[model samples]
Target: DQQVKQNSPSLSVQEGRISILNCDYTNSMFDYFLWYKKYPAEGPTFLISISSIKDKNEDGRFTVFLNKSAKHLSLHIVPSQPGDSAVYFCAASDWGYQKVTFGTGTKLQVIP
Candidate 1:
């Protein structure tokens, strides 16, 4: 079974608006969560992350929120830009575990 899952396959948002992406995990052992953005012909680029101890972490226009009890996490992008269009992946890793599980990914498009 997959440890992490992204129910939404894609998302569309107007430029200068907010884009929200969601992810869910079944493993409670996961202590760290990360969001990666991938462009075509390129590998995923690490965006932001949150620790289990923190409910929210923000970096500039990107923010990631984690809900431990709900086994869920979400990413918020404010003032979405056309350049931000890409496939977003959610990843989770346990404190003592070496393997990081990634979600299926959600393709986001920022319409001009």
Candidate 2:
């Protein structure tokens, strides 16, 4: 069973608009949430993260939110740009366990 899921396989947005990516998880034990961005033929790079203790974390134009009660999390990118286009993966893990579960990435395309 897939513990983490990104229902939307792809998303498209215009440049300078806000883009929202959603993720859901079945595991309640997850204490840390991470978002990664991957470009063609390259490894995924860590983007933003949030801990269970906090509902939100922001870095630059990227923000991550965790809803423990709903086992859901989302990443928001404001004024999305073409360079921000990539396959975004939502990952979750229990800090102590050190094992991470990743959702099938959602491909985001920004139109300039």
Candidate 3:
């Protein structure tokens, strides 16, 4: 059973606009939410993350929000640029579990 899911397979956003990526999880044991960005022929790199204790976390242009009650999370990128285009994966894990479940991913295209 897939615990994490990204309903949208792809998303398109214009350059300089805001990009929103959504994720949903069914596992209540998950306590950490993470976002990873992957480019062609490259490994997925950690982008941003949010702990279950907090509702939101921001780093520069990237922000992640966790809604525990809704079992959902979202990543927001403001002033989206072409370079930001990538396949974003939403991952979740429980504290000390050292195991993470990832969503299939959402391909984001930032059009210039």
Candidate 4:
């Protein structure tokens, strides 16, 4: 069973528009959540993260909201730019667990 899931495989948004990506997790043990943006072959870079104790976290153009009760999370990018086009992965981890469960990933296309 997939511990994490990104329902949409891809998403397209116009530049300066809002781009939203969704993810879901099945495990209640997960406490730490993270969002990573990847370009091509490079490894995923951490974008934003939030502990289960909080419901929302934001950084510049990116914002992540977590709903523990629903086991869902979302990443929102405001004023999306062409450079924002890339793949986004949602990951979850339990305290003291070295391994992180990652979603399949959502490819975001920000059209200029």
Backbone N/Cα/C clashes per model: 0, 0, 0, 0
Question: Taking the tens digit of each residue's C-alpha lDDT, what string does model 2 give over 1-112?
Answer: 9999999999999999999999999988899989999999999999998889999999999999888999999999998999999999999999999898999999999999
Q: Model 2: which residue pairs collide?
A: none
lDDT of 3 by residue, 73-102 (tens): 999999899999999999999978879899
Q: Give, for candidate 1, the lowest lDDT window spanning 10 residues.
A: 93-102
lDDT of 1: 0.96
lDDT of each: 0.96, 0.95, 0.97, 0.95
| Model 4: lowest-lDDT 10 consecutive positions | 93-102
Q: Over the full model, what C-alpha lDDT does candidate 2 score relative to the true structure?
A: 0.95
- In candidate 3, residue 14 scores what lDDT? 98
> Which RMSD values do the candidates have, in order?
0.7, 0.5, 0.4, 0.7
- In candidate 3, position 89 carries an lDDT of 100
Q: Per-residue lDDT tens digits of candidate 1, residues 11-69? A: 99999999999999998889999999999999999999998999999999999999888
RMSD of 2: 0.5
Model 3 earns a TM-score of: 0.99
Cα lDDT, model 1, residue 13: 99
For residues 1-82, write the lDDT of model 4, one tens digit per residue: 9999999999999999999999999999999999999999899999999999999999999999999999999999998999
| TM-score of each model, in listed order | 0.98, 0.98, 0.99, 0.97
TM-score of 1: 0.98
- lDDT score, residue 19, model 4? 99
